[model samples]
Target chain A: MLGDNDGILSGAHFLDGDHACAEGAIAAGCNFVAGYPITPSTEVVERLAWRFPGTGGTFIQMEDEIASSIAIQGAVWAGAKAMTVSSGPGISLMLEHIGLAAMTEVPCVFVNVQRGGPSTGLPTLPAQADMMQARWGSHGDYEVIALVPNSPQECFDLIIHAFNLSEQYRVPVLFMMDEVIGHMTEKVVVPPRDQIKITPRRYTKLPPGEYEPYRAGDDLVPDFAKAGDGHRFHITGLTHNEKGYPVMNAECQEQLVCRLVDKIRTNVEQISFFHEDGLEDADVVVITYGISSRVTMRAIREARKKGVKVGHLRLVVVWPFPEEYIRRLAKQIEAFVVPEINLGQVVLEVERCAAGTCDVISIQHAGGAVHKPRTIYDAIVEAVR
Target chain B: MSMTPAVENPVEQLLRSERMPHIWCPGCGIGTTVNCFARAVEECVSDLDNLIIVSGIGCTGRVAGYLELDSFHTTHGRAIPFATGLKLANPKLKVVVYSGDGDLIAIGGNHFIHAARRNADITVICVNNFNYAMTGGQIGPTTPLDAVGTTSPYGVCERPFNLPFLAESCGAVYVARWTAYHVRQMTRAMCEALNKRGFSFVEVITPCPTLYERRNRLGSGLDRMQWFKENSVIKNGVDTRECDIALRQKIVCGKFVDVDRPSLLEMVEAKMASVLHRRRWERMSREQQKPIAMRPMKG
Candidate 1:
């Protein structure tokens, strides 16, 4: 489906990642945004506050990140395409609602412009430490889609995909942006409304009496029914049956949780997205995402000049982890060198996927700054050795 | 079974009948409050389809689950903000937050104050059972000083909050307090709150027989209701600051604050309209008065 034309900024402009993200959400038909100001992420909401009114959307600066996070979920249930934005400490406060969104299958977006953390370590500097936290921050067994954007353009482009994924899967989609990508300025070309593909919400077609809120079709995602649609549906954070009533038994828990996980796990092939270069004959693969992916390119160029058979695999959709693809690549490659802003997060996943079939070298950084290309170059060299 | 045409309960239509018998314990006043709420919903809300009940995690929070209207059982202390979002996202829907004292006044205190401050269009029904009965009667923000709970076995040293005072001071458009025993007055208060335009709060003081009553040796839920009936002073329009209830003290209950105020959405729309209008007028004037070269460059 085409997006609302009023929301589409169909022109080329120099924009920061944060402003681009705000435009992306508007273009994606997001009608509600609730956020609390946090450094590096405040610009996204600020732009939304300025633009939403003109686009017939609602923007609310909530009291705190906790309120901002759950407010978006409430808006989602009220039949709006909704989202919230925050940085590390704010996202930390939003963890509980992230679990709520997962359990209740509330389709919403959570944008985390990553900053150095371990308790507000660096408010204005870059880090990809939240890569692991995005997948596991919320408690219990559940699955969510996390997209990593490397540049200002990708920030605009990928956030739309994030909303679509969340709506299509009825899950909270995390758009992970680091401080550099969030603050960096570059040209962003927003396509026309008709040219942009948007996934409309899969609202249930069944009558009020027949519709079961949790009942899924062949896609394993239940069609949504909003609050005032006369469905009179009940949504709870507790383990529930198809009737949306709390069913406190192991059978129900196993069924609900497995479906919550399997819906994404089984459809990983369709959900996984990555950009690869020279992987056909390369001996070593460089695995990275977000800002590190941008840094990895420089290191890869230098390594290629040094006669190393190195390839770059940039992850766009980080969660659901592209396990099968990684496993297959592990069998073909000598080693996978993973460099990220974090100490060693996504590298753990690479190591697990490799399963000792091939070497997995982690290039760790203590955040506050992006990799010095030479650091990743050294890891690429060591992996080849 | 006497089957001379089974007479149905009128309130059953507003409740999830199959989900009952409810989880509320015997002699618990939460059930009584729910009944009063149902009556209020029936009285005030013309369109049942547009009513949404949101509750946080607590015994009273289960009100959302029991109610047949579109409902949400949210995380602990988050019902207010969640309801605020619902109301703002779709102005047609009448959102309500029903939860316990500990859920609303303690962990969710910030959200509570902010929502009231914004005058978000939603009705808040807080069931104050004095302690956290669901967690085995732990001392809470509203637990009376010198009262005994599992967490306050040595007697509570901290002063309990005057919920009506908090609601009024925080800018709630309608603020009222009632005991579970005062079903008629409580129902009327709920009806008024449900019909109010902005943030409205109704605090219902109820007995927790299993945990609170047992731990404090306060006889039973019936005895507590009897006490409420005997001790509650109906002081309409009294200052909320003078309505504090210490242990075994006279509970001042009535409609305290009722005033008109623009809701959060109302203010947002007004501000947006004025700013956008000014911007459009400025742009038009600039286009007419200045040449294209002299105009400010678009970013």
Candidate 2:
């Protein structure tokens, strides 16, 4: 019953991890949510179903991950900020369509609250196994924005950021959260409607006579024409010119591919959102994200207290990764400690970004549990000191 | 009294003429499927504003290239998911997914079953050309067993998928099969399916002229049409057992199932009601959480 007129301090209450995510997405101005219930992420849909309508939005429980992903894509095309949350199996099912969204340059959000498995490994359990898949899950070399969230508040804030990035780049943004953060109940403060920043769809508010769907300019993002806008525009996953027509020529294919890739790559600075702590004169930097980052942060704090020179760099955006920052830190640091729920995913990114400057170490785990601060603390002490 | 000036059709009148019709080959079954779709569009609720046509990569997928509506031609076998997105985005739109046999059953098989299971409100018009006509007649999932094609040099070992049966099994509310020769029946089936409430599938067993016919010695496109006309039998009433027998003998080509299921959007909204209610009840007495001094943001 919260209204736009109600000038109330709408803050966070103690809720399960998934519900917090739902609330976060709602507050982030997500107007459409399409998903199927899978473990670790089901509560997200459950929370969204109720919250979406009151905001004059829609929530759809699609037949499967494929349908859910498609529905979200459609909702976004209609000029609404839309999202879908899923897990491992669901993500696998959506890989093909995710590629389509990428190729079509459709702005949408896909939340993969990771669960264990190549196929339905552990529905109720937590695992970060989809980290690699999130970046390279879909076939082909395409640029995708993936954000990793560690806590309930982040679940809310980054969803808004995710929506903004999707709109800005006109590409699907993957919000990769693990089952732990998805299920962990935490108190989060949602800002007032006026206080919260929102990115509306980049629409062509022109007369029907002057509309070109894939009209290119300095910005690779197409001018979106929502369904009710009366503008006739074509959208397809084919290799097309700026006019959105299927072009069979190699030159056209090259141009289209470059635009799709360059749109994200060139805008890396705008996409980068991270937190750095105690990097000055520190020998070891704890590089982590998602649920693992939370533990790594605590471990950094504990190690610092013990006079071990260890810092933490928590990445909010996992794709179009903060390579420059990591590269800069690599020169100063002796070792980069990357702790993740999976065996080793982001470590490779850190290693590549860091190159041979620092010893990139992976503190990995993949049983339905969070990496303890002690495990991270041991890595820091062993690597740096 | 003046008639309610028809909602001033805000969108451009999706003129069929906008689609210059010469692209398709002469005597092509794709033209028929496209015609059925065009006619079905008229039969569908006349909210052209919300009507979206999604097609996949195929000769039939080219349907989107010519259609004068809100159209999307997605990747191979990915039209179902793409249309699912469009349908979920705005439930107001009457979404129709047009794809070929290879596009629908082979690459897009997962999306197909799931869309049916979800009972997504989108209508799927699968033109079963049996062969991958666009890519030089590769053996598709719906390619008949022992049938010859470009990839299957000698013969195909895999049995063709019973598309209607598969749709019904996957939980589609309305499922039907018709050959290209069954022009009236196919168009009518498409119209009814388009007008239906939940996930509806109309599988048109269309002929492939260039590769499929040439390789299989099915003569010309006209000859293939005659084969369909002579082979297919219309069954108005029948049990599952009898239908299966007829299908096995390649005789029956009719609407197999028509039943309502909880559409994806409806089910989602209902579940959303409960989640929202529970959230409201809990949030009534409490406050939302403020951001911490330092933590990673979750999206």
Candidate 3:
């Protein structure tokens, strides 16, 4: 289906990643947003605050990150496409609610404009350190889709995909943007409303009495019923059965948790998005995501200039970590070099996938800044040697 | 054999009886409060489908699950903010936050005070059993002085919150206090709160028989109810500042604050309407003959 015309800007305009994200969410029919102001990520909510009222949307500045996180789920249950935005510290505070969103299968977006942090280390600086935390920070086992957009234009484009994937899978989709990308200004072309495709929420066609909220179809995704729909459905953080009633047993847990993980894990081919280059005849592949992916481009150029056969693979969807693709490439390539702002997070995944088939080289940074192209170029040269 | 039809309970329509027997223990006063809440729903809410019950993690948080409504049992201390989101998003749903004192006032204290200050349109029913009853009676924000619990075995030394006072000071439009012993009055207060348009709070003092009553040697749940019957003072217009509960002391309970004000959503809507109107007027003036300096007149 086409996006609503009211939300489409439909023109060329200079926009930062944060503002582009707001416009993207609006274009995706996001009617509600609850957020707390944090550096780098605060502009997303600010733009929404200024723009939502005009578009017949609701934007609330919640009390804290925790409130901001859970409030979006509430809005989701109330039959709106909702989201919350924060930085690392705020995302840390929001982890519990992320788990809640996962447990109850609430379709919502959580935007984290990445910052350098173990705890408030550098609020206004860029880092890709949260790559692992976005997948595993929330307690218990569940799957979520995470997207990384390197430019302002992709930020405008991919956030709409983020919302659609969330609605399709009934899972929390993470919009992972670094401070550099979030703050970078560029011209973003928003197409006409009819040109933009949107995935409408899968509301059940079953009658209220016939609907069992947790009963999944063959696709392993259940239909959704909104509040005040006379469904009178109950959802909880506890392990529940098909009727959405709490059932405290291992069998119920196994059934529910396994499906939660399998829905995205089995659909990785459909959900995974990446940009590949020069893999046809390259001895070495440089794998990266987020801002690091952009830096990898510069390093790859330098490596090519040095007469080294270096391939580039940029992860657009980071979580559900492109393991199968990496494994296939690991066999074909001699080595894989990973350059990230963090100290060897995504490198671990590369090493696990490479699994002795190829040597994995990690160019680590403790992250107040991005990796210099020189460092990555050296890593690429060493990997091929 | 002669056939006899089953006589359904009066409030059975509002409950998920298939999920029963409930988890609340014998002699637990939480069920009594639920009865009053059910009665209030029966009397006040005409559109049952539009009512949403949200609760945080605790003994009282189970209220959402047992009620046959569009309900959510959310994370600990988060029911208010969740309800705030629900109410703001739809504006037609009558949202309610039902949880324990520890869930609403301690871990959720920041959200509680802020939601009241914002005047979000939701009703908060905080079941105060003097401690964290769900977690085996740990010390909590509402645990009275000298109360003995697992965490406060030596006796609670810190000052506890006067919840009615806290609610009133934080700008709750409707504030009331009632005990499980005062079911009729509690039901009336819940009805009033349900009908109110802004943030409304009702603090129900109930007995946590397994942990609070046994640990404090308060005999049993029946004895606690007897104590409430004798000690509770009915003061309808009394100041909220005097409604604090102490160790085995006279409990003052009543309706304290009731006022009318525009809610958070209402204020947001009005502001947005005015801004959009002014912008539209400005756009018209710029395209027509009016000067750019001219402003729209205030009502």
Best by DockQ: 3
Give the range where candidate 1 chain B is weakest over 10 consecutive residues by summed lDDT: B289-298
lDDT of 3 by residue, A251-327 (tens): 99999999999999999999999999998899999998888888889889989999999999999998988899999
Candidate 2 C-alpha lDDT tens digits along A206-316: 677677787766877777788645565667777877656677898988888888899888888888988888878899989888888777877888888889988888888
Q: Order of candidates by lDDT, top first? A: 3, 1, 2
Fraction of true contacts retained by every candidate, in order, equals 0.82, 0.60, 0.83
DockQ comparison, 1 vs 2, better candidate: 1
lDDT of 1 at B3: 61
Q: Candidate 2: where is the Cα deviation over 4 Å?
A: A1-9, A53-56, A116-125, A366-368, A382-385, B1-27, B39-49, B75-78, B105-120, B138-146, B149-178, B181-201, B226-299
| Model 1 CAPRI quality | acceptable
1 against 3, candidate with superior lDDT: 3
Question: For residues A165-262, what per-residue lDDT tens digits would candidate 1 score against the true structure?
Answer: 99899999999998999989999999988887899999889999999999987778998999988999899999999989999999999999999999
For all candidates, what are the clash counts? 0, 23, 0
Each model's RMSD to truth, in Å?
Answer: 7.2, 9.1, 6.0
- Scored by TM against the true chain B, the candidates give 0.91, 0.83, 0.91
